[model samples]
Target chain A: MERLGSGGREGARRIGEVLTWDPLVRLTHWSVALLVLLNGAVLEDEGQPHVWVGYAVLGLVAARFLWGLVGPARARFTSFPPSLSAARLHVDEVMHGRERRHESHNPLGALMAYNLWATLLAICATGLMMESVAFFGVEWVEEAHEALFAWLMISVGLHVSGVILESFLSGRNLVRAMVGSFHKRSGGGA
Target chain B: MKLAPFALALAFAASPVIAQEVAQGDKIGTEIGAIASALSERGYEVRKTEREDGKVEVYAVREGRRFEIYVDPETGAVTRVKEKH
Candidate 1:
Protein backbone atom coordinates (compact mmCIF):
# COMPACT_ATOMS: atom_id res chain seq x y z
CA MET A 1 0.00 0.00 0.00
CA GLU A 2 1.18 3.56 -0.72
CA ARG A 3 2.16 5.57 2.34
CA LEU A 4 -0.99 7.29 3.65
CA GLY A 5 0.37 9.56 6.36
CA SER A 6 1.86 12.82 5.06
CA GLY A 7 3.47 11.04 2.09
CA GLY A 8 1.64 10.85 -1.22
CA ARG A 9 1.93 11.98 -4.85
CA GLU A 10 0.44 15.27 -3.77
CA GLY A 11 3.28 15.58 -1.21
CA ALA A 12 3.02 15.95 2.56
CA ARG A 13 2.09 19.61 2.65
CA ARG A 14 -1.61 20.41 2.57
CA ILE A 15 -2.80 23.11 0.20
CA GLY A 16 -4.59 25.10 2.91
CA GLU A 17 -3.63 25.99 6.46
CA VAL A 18 -5.70 25.46 9.60
CA LEU A 19 -5.84 27.79 12.55
CA THR A 20 -8.65 26.25 14.51
CA TRP A 21 -10.47 28.46 16.96
CA ASP A 22 -10.01 27.74 20.62
CA PRO A 23 -12.74 25.29 21.60
CA LEU A 24 -13.94 27.48 24.45
CA VAL A 25 -14.02 30.57 22.26
CA ARG A 26 -15.90 28.82 19.45
CA LEU A 27 -18.35 27.22 21.89
CA THR A 28 -19.00 30.50 23.62
CA HIS A 29 -19.37 32.38 20.35
CA TRP A 30 -21.83 29.98 18.70
CA SER A 31 -23.75 29.18 21.85
CA VAL A 32 -24.10 32.86 22.73
CA ALA A 33 -25.31 33.60 19.20
CA LEU A 34 -27.93 30.86 19.41
CA LEU A 35 -29.11 31.94 22.84
CA VAL A 36 -29.33 35.60 21.86
CA LEU A 37 -31.25 34.77 18.68
CA LEU A 38 -33.63 32.49 20.55
CA ASN A 39 -34.11 35.00 23.35
CA GLY A 40 -34.90 37.72 20.85
CA ALA A 41 -37.04 35.72 18.42
CA VAL A 42 -38.78 32.80 20.14
CA LEU A 43 -38.79 33.77 23.81
CA GLU A 44 -41.67 36.24 23.58
CA ASP A 45 -44.02 33.69 25.15
CA GLU A 46 -42.76 34.51 28.70
CA GLY A 47 -41.85 30.92 29.38
CA GLN A 48 -39.44 29.45 31.92
CA PRO A 49 -37.06 28.30 29.20
CA HIS A 50 -36.93 31.85 27.90
CA VAL A 51 -35.73 33.23 31.22
CA TRP A 52 -33.19 30.43 31.57
CA VAL A 53 -31.93 31.10 28.08
CA GLY A 54 -31.49 34.76 28.95
CA TYR A 55 -29.45 33.84 31.97
CA ALA A 56 -27.38 31.48 29.86
CA VAL A 57 -26.74 34.17 27.30
CA LEU A 58 -25.71 36.61 29.99
CA GLY A 59 -23.27 34.08 31.40
CA LEU A 60 -21.85 33.36 27.97
CA VAL A 61 -21.34 37.06 27.28
CA ALA A 62 -19.58 37.53 30.60
CA ALA A 63 -17.30 34.58 29.87
CA ARG A 64 -16.57 35.77 26.34
CA PHE A 65 -15.75 39.24 27.61
CA LEU A 66 -13.20 37.78 29.98
CA TRP A 67 -11.86 35.46 27.30
CA GLY A 68 -11.27 38.33 24.91
CA LEU A 69 -8.69 39.63 27.37
CA VAL A 70 -6.76 36.35 27.46
CA GLY A 71 -7.60 34.35 24.39
CA PRO A 72 -5.85 33.34 21.19
CA ALA A 73 -4.06 35.87 18.99
CA ARG A 74 -6.81 36.01 16.40
CA ALA A 75 -9.48 36.19 19.08
CA ARG A 76 -7.91 39.17 20.82
CA PHE A 77 -9.35 42.63 20.32
CA THR A 78 -5.85 43.99 19.73
CA SER A 79 -5.67 41.94 16.55
CA PHE A 80 -8.24 44.30 15.02
CA PRO A 81 -7.77 47.91 15.96
CA PRO A 82 -10.84 50.13 15.87
CA SER A 83 -9.91 52.86 13.40
CA LEU A 84 -12.60 55.18 12.09
CA SER A 85 -10.38 56.40 9.26
CA ALA A 86 -9.62 52.86 8.18
CA ALA A 87 -13.29 51.93 8.36
CA ARG A 88 -14.27 55.00 6.35
CA LEU A 89 -11.67 54.17 3.73
CA HIS A 90 -12.88 50.57 3.52
CA VAL A 91 -16.47 51.79 3.16
CA ASP A 92 -15.42 54.15 0.39
CA GLU A 93 -13.65 51.30 -1.34
CA VAL A 94 -16.64 49.00 -1.04
CA MET A 95 -18.94 51.70 -2.44
CA HIS A 96 -16.55 52.19 -5.34
CA GLY A 97 -16.37 48.45 -6.02
CA ARG A 98 -12.72 48.24 -5.04
CA GLU A 99 -12.63 46.15 -1.86
CA ARG A 100 -9.53 44.33 -0.68
CA ARG A 101 -9.06 40.74 0.51
CA HIS A 102 -8.87 40.29 4.29
CA GLU A 103 -7.95 37.06 6.01
CA SER A 104 -9.64 38.39 9.11
CA HIS A 105 -12.43 40.95 9.38
CA ASN A 106 -11.94 44.03 7.21
CA PRO A 107 -12.16 47.46 8.77
CA LEU A 108 -15.88 47.77 7.97
CA GLY A 109 -16.48 44.26 9.23
CA ALA A 110 -14.60 45.05 12.44
CA LEU A 111 -16.79 48.09 12.93
CA MET A 112 -19.82 45.90 12.53
CA ALA A 113 -18.43 43.53 15.14
CA TYR A 114 -17.99 46.46 17.50
CA ASN A 115 -21.54 47.61 16.85
CA LEU A 116 -22.89 44.10 17.37
CA TRP A 117 -21.19 43.69 20.75
CA ALA A 118 -22.14 47.19 21.93
CA THR A 119 -25.74 46.69 20.92
CA LEU A 120 -25.79 43.27 22.53
CA LEU A 121 -24.49 44.78 25.79
CA ALA A 122 -27.17 47.44 25.61
CA ILE A 123 -29.79 44.79 25.02
CA CYS A 124 -28.65 42.88 28.07
CA ALA A 125 -28.60 46.02 30.21
CA THR A 126 -31.99 47.26 29.06
CA GLY A 127 -33.38 43.79 29.43
CA LEU A 128 -32.23 43.65 33.04
CA MET A 129 -33.59 47.13 33.64
CA MET A 130 -36.97 46.13 32.23
CA GLU A 131 -37.23 43.57 35.01
CA SER A 132 -37.20 46.28 37.68
CA VAL A 133 -40.27 48.13 38.98
CA ALA A 134 -38.76 51.55 38.23
CA PHE A 135 -38.10 50.72 34.60
CA PHE A 136 -40.67 48.01 34.11
CA GLY A 137 -43.62 49.11 32.01
CA VAL A 138 -41.69 52.28 31.26
CA GLU A 139 -42.31 53.07 27.61
CA TRP A 140 -38.93 54.66 26.93
CA VAL A 141 -36.83 51.80 28.29
CA GLU A 142 -38.92 49.28 26.44
CA GLU A 143 -38.72 51.33 23.29
CA ALA A 144 -34.98 51.71 23.63
CA HIS A 145 -34.55 47.97 23.97
CA GLU A 146 -36.77 47.36 20.97
CA ALA A 147 -34.91 49.92 18.95
CA LEU A 148 -31.60 48.30 19.83
CA PHE A 149 -32.98 44.97 18.71
CA ALA A 150 -33.98 46.44 15.36
CA TRP A 151 -30.55 47.99 14.96
CA LEU A 152 -28.88 44.72 15.85
CA MET A 153 -30.96 42.87 13.32
CA ILE A 154 -29.96 45.31 10.63
CA SER A 155 -26.30 45.04 11.65
CA VAL A 156 -26.52 41.27 11.55
CA GLY A 157 -27.99 41.40 8.04
CA LEU A 158 -25.23 43.70 6.86
CA HIS A 159 -22.59 41.51 8.49
CA VAL A 160 -23.85 38.47 6.62
CA SER A 161 -23.93 40.40 3.36
CA GLY A 162 -20.37 41.57 3.95
CA VAL A 163 -19.28 37.99 4.52
CA ILE A 164 -20.86 36.84 1.26
CA LEU A 165 -19.38 39.75 -0.65
CA GLU A 166 -15.93 39.22 0.79
CA SER A 167 -16.04 35.49 0.12
CA PHE A 168 -16.59 36.13 -3.57
CA LEU A 169 -14.20 39.03 -3.74
CA SER A 170 -11.43 37.17 -1.97
CA GLY A 171 -12.16 33.94 -3.84
CA ARG A 172 -12.27 32.07 -0.56
CA ASN A 173 -15.06 30.34 1.33
CA LEU A 174 -15.33 32.57 4.38
CA VAL A 175 -18.16 30.62 5.92
CA ARG A 176 -16.23 27.40 5.61
CA ALA A 177 -13.22 29.08 7.20
CA MET A 178 -15.36 30.18 10.11
CA VAL A 179 -16.68 26.68 10.59
CA GLY A 180 -13.51 24.72 9.85
CA SER A 181 -10.95 27.36 10.87
CA PHE A 182 -9.11 27.05 7.61
CA HIS A 183 -8.03 29.86 5.32
CA LYS A 184 -6.48 29.84 1.89
CA ARG A 185 -2.76 30.47 2.08
CA SER A 186 -2.52 34.17 1.25
CA GLY A 187 0.58 36.35 1.13
CA GLY A 188 -0.54 38.14 4.36
CA GLY A 189 -2.55 40.80 2.55
CA ALA A 190 -5.60 40.73 4.84
CA MET B 1 -70.01 18.59 61.70
CA LYS B 2 -71.97 21.57 63.08
CA LEU B 3 -68.85 23.49 64.16
CA ALA B 4 -67.03 22.99 60.83
CA PRO B 5 -68.76 25.90 59.08
CA PHE B 6 -67.98 28.28 61.94
CA ALA B 7 -64.32 27.20 61.91
CA LEU B 8 -64.17 27.42 58.12
CA ALA B 9 -65.70 30.89 58.14
CA LEU B 10 -63.35 32.03 60.90
CA ALA B 11 -60.37 30.59 59.04
CA PHE B 12 -61.50 32.22 55.82
CA ALA B 13 -61.83 35.58 57.51
CA ALA B 14 -58.39 35.41 59.16
CA SER B 15 -56.70 33.57 56.30
CA PRO B 16 -56.14 36.68 54.18
CA VAL B 17 -54.07 38.49 56.82
CA ILE B 18 -52.23 35.34 57.80
CA ALA B 19 -51.55 34.42 54.21
CA GLN B 20 -50.39 37.94 53.48
CA GLU B 21 -47.93 37.86 56.36
CA VAL B 22 -46.66 34.42 55.42
CA ALA B 23 -46.40 35.31 51.75
CA GLN B 24 -44.51 38.51 52.49
CA GLY B 25 -42.14 36.75 54.85
CA ASP B 26 -41.59 33.87 52.48
CA LYS B 27 -41.02 36.26 49.60
CA ILE B 28 -38.37 38.16 51.49
CA GLY B 29 -36.56 35.13 52.84
CA THR B 30 -36.66 33.09 49.65
CA GLU B 31 -35.90 36.03 47.43
CA ILE B 32 -32.90 36.97 49.54
CA GLY B 33 -31.55 33.47 49.74
CA ALA B 34 -32.03 32.77 46.05
CA ILE B 35 -30.58 36.07 44.92
CA ALA B 36 -27.71 35.85 47.34
CA SER B 37 -26.90 32.32 46.23
CA ALA B 38 -27.17 33.17 42.57
CA LEU B 39 -24.95 36.22 42.90
CA SER B 40 -22.44 34.52 45.15
CA GLU B 41 -22.19 31.65 42.71
CA ARG B 42 -21.39 34.23 40.08
CA GLY B 43 -18.86 35.89 42.46
CA TYR B 44 -20.93 38.63 44.06
CA GLU B 45 -21.02 39.14 47.78
CA VAL B 46 -24.60 39.59 48.93
CA ARG B 47 -25.22 41.94 51.85
CA LYS B 48 -28.92 41.60 52.57
CA THR B 49 -32.43 40.93 51.23
CA GLU B 50 -35.69 42.69 52.01
CA ARG B 51 -39.43 42.72 51.25
CA GLU B 52 -41.93 45.53 51.25
CA ASP B 53 -45.64 45.68 50.40
CA GLY B 54 -45.74 47.95 47.38
CA LYS B 55 -46.03 47.84 43.62
CA VAL B 56 -42.76 45.94 43.82
CA GLU B 57 -41.88 44.22 47.09
CA VAL B 58 -39.11 41.65 47.09
CA TYR B 59 -35.47 42.61 46.67
CA ALA B 60 -31.95 41.30 47.27
CA VAL B 61 -29.03 43.36 48.46
CA ARG B 62 -25.53 42.86 47.19
CA GLU B 63 -23.28 45.86 47.85
CA GLY B 64 -26.35 48.11 47.38
CA ARG B 65 -29.45 46.12 46.47
CA ARG B 66 -27.80 44.74 43.37
CA PHE B 67 -30.89 42.73 42.45
CA GLU B 68 -34.56 43.39 43.17
CA ILE B 69 -35.95 40.02 42.12
CA TYR B 70 -39.66 39.29 41.89
CA VAL B 71 -40.21 35.59 42.04
CA ASP B 72 -43.22 33.31 41.71
CA PRO B 73 -42.37 30.48 44.09
CA GLU B 74 -45.11 28.37 42.60
CA THR B 75 -43.16 28.21 39.36
CA GLY B 76 -39.67 28.95 40.73
CA ALA B 77 -39.06 31.59 38.08
CA VAL B 78 -37.87 35.16 38.63
CA THR B 79 -40.64 37.32 37.23
CA ARG B 80 -38.29 40.29 37.25
CA VAL B 81 -35.23 41.93 38.80
CA LYS B 82 -34.43 45.56 39.47
CA GLU B 83 -30.73 45.63 38.84
CA LYS B 84 -30.73 49.41 38.64
CA HIS B 85 -32.83 50.53 41.60
Candidate 2:
Protein backbone atom coordinates (compact mmCIF):
# COMPACT_ATOMS: atom_id res chain seq x y z
CA MET A 1 0.00 0.00 0.00
CA GLU A 2 2.87 2.36 0.84
CA ARG A 3 4.62 1.46 -2.47
CA LEU A 4 1.47 2.62 -4.39
CA GLY A 5 1.67 6.08 -2.80
CA SER A 6 5.12 6.69 -4.37
CA GLY A 7 4.21 4.96 -7.61
CA GLY A 8 1.83 7.76 -8.82
CA ARG A 9 -1.15 7.19 -11.27
CA GLU A 10 0.15 3.76 -12.35
CA GLY A 11 -0.57 2.43 -8.88
CA ALA A 12 -4.01 4.09 -8.87
CA ARG A 13 -5.30 1.69 -11.51
CA ARG A 14 -3.83 -1.12 -13.56
CA ILE A 15 -3.90 -0.96 -17.37
CA GLY A 16 -7.09 -2.42 -18.93
CA GLU A 17 -8.87 -2.06 -15.61
CA VAL A 18 -12.52 -0.97 -15.90
CA LEU A 19 -13.73 2.15 -14.12
CA THR A 20 -17.33 2.15 -12.87
CA TRP A 21 -20.22 4.59 -13.15
CA ASP A 22 -22.67 5.63 -10.45
CA PRO A 23 -26.07 3.94 -10.69
CA LEU A 24 -27.89 7.27 -11.15
CA VAL A 25 -25.36 8.18 -13.81
CA ARG A 26 -26.03 4.98 -15.74
CA LEU A 27 -29.81 5.38 -15.39
CA THR A 28 -29.87 8.92 -16.72
CA HIS A 29 -27.48 8.11 -19.59
CA TRP A 30 -29.44 5.15 -21.00
CA SER A 31 -32.87 6.71 -20.43
CA VAL A 32 -31.91 9.79 -22.43
CA ALA A 33 -30.61 7.62 -25.26
CA LEU A 34 -33.79 5.57 -25.48
CA LEU A 35 -36.02 8.65 -25.31
CA VAL A 36 -33.99 10.24 -28.10
CA LEU A 37 -34.58 7.17 -30.22
CA LEU A 38 -38.33 7.32 -29.59
CA ASN A 39 -38.83 11.01 -30.20
CA GLY A 40 -36.24 11.48 -32.92
CA ALA A 41 -36.95 8.40 -35.03
CA VAL A 42 -39.91 6.31 -33.89
CA LEU A 43 -42.65 8.79 -32.93
CA GLU A 44 -44.56 11.33 -34.97
CA ASP A 45 -43.37 14.95 -34.96
CA GLU A 46 -46.56 16.76 -33.85
CA GLY A 47 -48.38 14.67 -31.30
CA GLN A 48 -48.98 14.08 -27.59
CA PRO A 49 -46.50 11.19 -27.39
CA HIS A 50 -43.70 13.21 -28.93
CA VAL A 51 -44.40 16.08 -26.56
CA TRP A 52 -44.37 13.84 -23.50
CA VAL A 53 -41.26 12.01 -24.61
CA GLY A 54 -39.49 15.32 -24.99
CA TYR A 55 -40.51 16.24 -21.45
CA ALA A 56 -39.20 12.90 -20.21
CA VAL A 57 -35.85 13.51 -21.88
CA LEU A 58 -35.65 16.96 -20.32
CA GLY A 59 -36.42 15.46 -16.92
CA LEU A 60 -33.71 12.83 -17.31
CA VAL A 61 -31.18 15.41 -18.39
CA ALA A 62 -32.11 17.55 -15.41
CA ALA A 63 -31.57 14.60 -13.12
CA ARG A 64 -28.22 13.88 -14.68
CA PHE A 65 -27.21 17.52 -14.43
CA LEU A 66 -28.04 17.64 -10.74
CA TRP A 67 -26.18 14.36 -10.22
CA GLY A 68 -23.17 15.96 -11.86
CA LEU A 69 -23.18 18.56 -9.08
CA VAL A 70 -23.66 16.30 -6.00
CA GLY A 71 -22.97 12.79 -7.26
CA PRO A 72 -19.92 10.59 -6.77
CA ALA A 73 -16.43 11.80 -7.57
CA ARG A 74 -16.19 10.36 -11.04
CA ALA A 75 -19.61 11.67 -12.06
CA ARG A 76 -18.87 15.20 -10.92
CA PHE A 77 -18.31 18.00 -13.45
CA THR A 78 -15.13 18.99 -11.58
CA SER A 79 -13.63 15.65 -12.52
CA PHE A 80 -13.78 16.36 -16.24
CA PRO A 81 -14.28 19.99 -17.23
CA PRO A 82 -14.60 20.52 -20.98
CA SER A 83 -11.39 21.86 -22.50
CA LEU A 84 -10.11 21.68 -26.06
CA SER A 85 -6.43 22.25 -25.19
CA ALA A 86 -6.55 19.48 -22.61
CA ALA A 87 -8.17 17.25 -25.23
CA ARG A 88 -5.41 18.19 -27.67
CA LEU A 89 -2.81 17.28 -25.05
CA HIS A 90 -4.63 14.00 -24.42
CA VAL A 91 -4.43 13.20 -28.14
CA ASP A 92 -0.76 14.02 -28.04
CA GLU A 93 -0.24 11.77 -25.03
CA VAL A 94 -2.02 8.90 -26.79
CA MET A 95 -0.06 9.48 -29.97
CA HIS A 96 3.18 9.37 -28.01
CA GLY A 97 2.19 6.06 -26.39
CA ARG A 98 1.86 7.62 -22.96
CA GLU A 99 -1.83 6.98 -22.49
CA ARG A 100 -3.07 7.95 -19.04
CA ARG A 101 -6.24 6.29 -17.81
CA HIS A 102 -8.74 8.73 -16.36
CA GLU A 103 -11.14 8.13 -13.49
CA SER A 104 -13.76 10.30 -15.23
CA HIS A 105 -14.43 10.87 -18.93
CA ASN A 106 -11.39 11.64 -21.09
CA PRO A 107 -11.09 15.30 -22.08
CA LEU A 108 -12.59 14.81 -25.54
CA GLY A 109 -15.36 12.72 -24.02
CA ALA A 110 -16.14 15.61 -21.68
CA LEU A 111 -16.48 17.97 -24.61
CA MET A 112 -18.88 15.55 -26.28
CA ALA A 113 -20.88 15.15 -23.10
CA TYR A 114 -21.37 18.89 -22.69
CA ASN A 115 -22.20 19.33 -26.38
CA LEU A 116 -24.79 16.57 -26.24
CA TRP A 117 -26.53 18.03 -23.17
CA ALA A 118 -26.57 21.58 -24.53
CA THR A 119 -27.92 20.38 -27.86
CA LEU A 120 -30.61 18.42 -26.06
CA LEU A 121 -31.65 21.48 -24.05
CA ALA A 122 -31.80 23.55 -27.23
CA ILE A 123 -33.99 20.92 -28.81
CA CYS A 124 -36.22 20.85 -25.76
CA ALA A 125 -36.58 24.63 -25.76
CA THR A 126 -37.53 24.67 -29.42
CA GLY A 127 -39.84 21.71 -28.94
CA LEU A 128 -41.66 23.47 -26.11
CA MET A 129 -41.87 26.61 -28.22
CA MET A 130 -43.44 24.64 -31.03
CA GLU A 131 -46.15 23.43 -28.71
CA SER A 132 -47.35 26.97 -28.22
CA VAL A 133 -50.13 28.04 -30.59
CA ALA A 134 -48.03 30.98 -31.81
CA PHE A 135 -45.21 28.74 -33.00
CA PHE A 136 -47.32 25.80 -34.09
CA GLY A 137 -46.94 25.17 -37.82
CA VAL A 138 -44.46 28.04 -38.09
CA GLU A 139 -42.06 27.14 -40.91
CA TRP A 140 -38.85 28.43 -39.31
CA VAL A 141 -39.51 26.83 -35.92
CA GLU A 142 -40.26 23.47 -37.50
CA GLU A 143 -37.21 23.67 -39.73
CA ALA A 144 -34.95 24.62 -36.84
CA HIS A 145 -36.32 21.79 -34.76
CA GLU A 146 -35.74 19.31 -37.57
CA ALA A 147 -32.28 20.67 -38.24
CA LEU A 148 -31.33 20.46 -34.58
CA PHE A 149 -32.55 16.87 -34.47
CA ALA A 150 -30.37 16.07 -37.48
CA TRP A 151 -27.39 17.62 -35.75
CA LEU A 152 -28.16 15.67 -32.57
CA MET A 153 -28.21 12.41 -34.54
CA ILE A 154 -24.81 13.24 -36.00
CA SER A 155 -23.42 14.02 -32.53
CA VAL A 156 -24.90 10.80 -31.16
CA GLY A 157 -23.07 8.86 -33.90
CA LEU A 158 -19.84 10.58 -32.96
CA HIS A 159 -20.36 9.94 -29.23
CA VAL A 160 -20.91 6.22 -29.87
CA SER A 161 -17.83 6.10 -32.11
CA GLY A 162 -15.77 7.85 -29.46
CA VAL A 163 -16.86 5.36 -26.82
CA ILE A 164 -16.00 2.42 -29.08
CA LEU A 165 -12.62 3.87 -30.02
CA GLU A 166 -11.72 4.60 -26.41
CA SER A 167 -12.77 1.14 -25.33
CA PHE A 168 -10.70 -0.44 -28.08
CA LEU A 169 -7.67 1.57 -27.08
CA SER A 170 -8.12 1.00 -23.34
CA GLY A 171 -9.17 -2.67 -23.53
CA ARG A 172 -12.03 -1.94 -21.15
CA ASN A 173 -15.71 -2.71 -21.69
CA LEU A 174 -17.17 0.73 -20.97
CA VAL A 175 -20.69 -0.38 -21.78
CA ARG A 176 -20.44 -2.94 -19.00
CA ALA A 177 -19.03 -0.35 -16.64
CA MET A 178 -21.90 1.94 -17.55
CA VAL A 179 -24.61 -0.71 -17.25
CA GLY A 180 -23.44 -2.82 -14.31
CA SER A 181 -20.42 -1.08 -12.78
CA PHE A 182 -18.58 -4.43 -13.03
CA HIS A 183 -14.90 -3.60 -12.67
CA LYS A 184 -13.05 -6.96 -12.67
CA ARG A 185 -9.74 -5.82 -14.19
CA SER A 186 -9.58 -8.17 -17.23
CA GLY A 187 -9.65 -11.74 -15.85
CA GLY A 188 -13.00 -12.92 -17.38
CA GLY A 189 -16.71 -12.33 -18.08
CA ALA A 190 -18.49 -10.96 -21.17
CA MET B 1 -36.77 3.96 -15.59
CA LYS B 2 -40.20 2.98 -16.83
CA LEU B 3 -41.23 3.90 -20.39
CA ALA B 4 -44.71 3.06 -19.09
CA PRO B 5 -45.89 6.60 -19.71
CA PHE B 6 -44.81 6.24 -23.32
CA ALA B 7 -46.16 2.71 -23.71
CA LEU B 8 -49.36 3.85 -22.01
CA ALA B 9 -49.79 6.19 -24.96
CA LEU B 10 -52.12 3.66 -26.71
CA ALA B 11 -53.23 4.49 -30.87
CA PHE B 12 -52.83 7.94 -29.42
CA ALA B 13 -53.05 9.37 -33.40
CA ALA B 14 -52.53 7.75 -36.94
CA SER B 15 -54.04 6.85 -40.46
CA PRO B 16 -50.97 5.65 -38.95
CA VAL B 17 -49.59 9.10 -37.70
CA ILE B 18 -49.57 5.26 -36.00
CA ALA B 19 -51.02 3.65 -39.39
CA GLN B 20 -48.64 5.08 -42.45
CA GLU B 21 -47.85 8.21 -44.45
CA VAL B 22 -49.39 10.41 -47.11
CA ALA B 23 -48.03 11.86 -50.32
CA GLN B 24 -49.37 14.66 -52.50
CA GLY B 25 -50.38 13.71 -56.00
CA ASP B 26 -53.02 15.30 -58.30
CA LYS B 27 -54.76 11.99 -59.04
CA ILE B 28 -56.13 11.61 -55.50
CA GLY B 29 -57.31 15.24 -55.19
CA THR B 30 -60.94 14.57 -56.17
CA GLU B 31 -61.38 11.79 -53.68
CA ILE B 32 -59.75 13.88 -50.96
CA GLY B 33 -61.98 16.87 -51.81
CA ALA B 34 -65.13 14.77 -51.67
CA ILE B 35 -64.06 13.35 -48.32
CA ALA B 36 -63.28 16.86 -47.09
CA SER B 37 -66.78 18.11 -48.10
CA ALA B 38 -68.45 15.17 -46.41
CA LEU B 39 -66.41 15.82 -43.25
CA SER B 40 -67.34 19.54 -43.47
CA GLU B 41 -71.03 18.64 -43.61
CA ARG B 42 -70.55 16.61 -40.44
CA GLY B 43 -69.42 19.79 -38.57
CA TYR B 44 -65.74 19.05 -38.95
CA GLU B 45 -63.66 21.98 -40.24
CA VAL B 46 -61.41 20.19 -42.66
CA ARG B 47 -57.79 21.24 -42.30
CA LYS B 48 -56.05 19.27 -45.06
CA THR B 49 -56.66 16.26 -47.31
CA GLU B 50 -54.19 13.85 -48.79
CA ARG B 51 -53.78 10.33 -50.21
CA GLU B 52 -52.41 7.88 -47.71
CA ASP B 53 -51.92 4.29 -48.87
CA GLY B 54 -54.71 4.69 -51.49
CA LYS B 55 -57.19 6.05 -48.91
CA VAL B 56 -58.44 9.60 -48.61
CA GLU B 57 -57.21 11.01 -45.29
CA VAL B 58 -58.99 14.17 -44.18
CA TYR B 59 -57.63 16.04 -41.18
CA ALA B 60 -60.28 18.11 -39.48
CA VAL B 61 -61.22 19.81 -36.22
CA ARG B 62 -64.58 20.06 -34.46
CA GLU B 63 -65.29 21.48 -30.99
CA GLY B 64 -61.51 21.85 -30.42
CA ARG B 65 -60.84 18.15 -31.07
CA ARG B 66 -58.74 17.15 -34.09
CA PHE B 67 -59.69 14.04 -36.07
CA GLU B 68 -58.30 11.89 -38.82
CA ILE B 69 -61.11 10.77 -41.14
CA TYR B 70 -60.12 7.88 -43.40
CA VAL B 71 -62.25 7.49 -46.53
CA ASP B 72 -62.18 4.57 -48.96
CA PRO B 73 -61.06 5.88 -52.33
CA GLU B 74 -63.01 3.29 -54.32
CA THR B 75 -66.29 3.36 -52.36
CA GLY B 76 -66.12 6.98 -51.09
CA ALA B 77 -67.28 5.57 -47.78
CA VAL B 78 -65.89 6.48 -44.36
CA THR B 79 -63.86 3.53 -43.09
CA ARG B 80 -62.25 4.83 -39.91
CA VAL B 81 -62.34 7.91 -37.72
CA LYS B 82 -59.50 8.57 -35.27
CA GLU B 83 -59.15 11.35 -32.74
CA LYS B 84 -55.94 12.82 -31.32
CA HIS B 85 -55.90 11.92 -27.68
Clashing pairs in 2: B14-B17, B14-B18, B16-B19, B16-B20
**How well is each residue in A5-93 modelled by candidate 2, as lDDT tens digits?**
22223112232456446667878889999999998789987679999999999999999899888877678899999999999999898
Measured with DockQ on alpha carbons, how good is candidate 2? Answer: 0.07
Error of 2 at A102 (Å): 0.9
Record all residue pairs in model 1 with backbone atoms less than 3 Å apart, i.e. clashing. none
Candidate 2 structure, TM-score to reference: 0.64
TM-score of each: 0.57, 0.64
Top candidate, metric DockQ = 2
Cα shift from native, residue A90, model 1 (Å):
2.1
Off by over 4 Å in 1: A1-20, A93-103, A181-190, B1-85
Error of 2 at A43 (Å): 1.7
Write candidate 1's Cα lDDT for A44-133 as tens digits: 623557666766877887786776677655666776667899899987887888877653467887788778778888887887776654
| Model 1 chain A poorest 10 in a row by lDDT | A6-15
- List RMSD in Å for every model shown: 13.0, 13.3
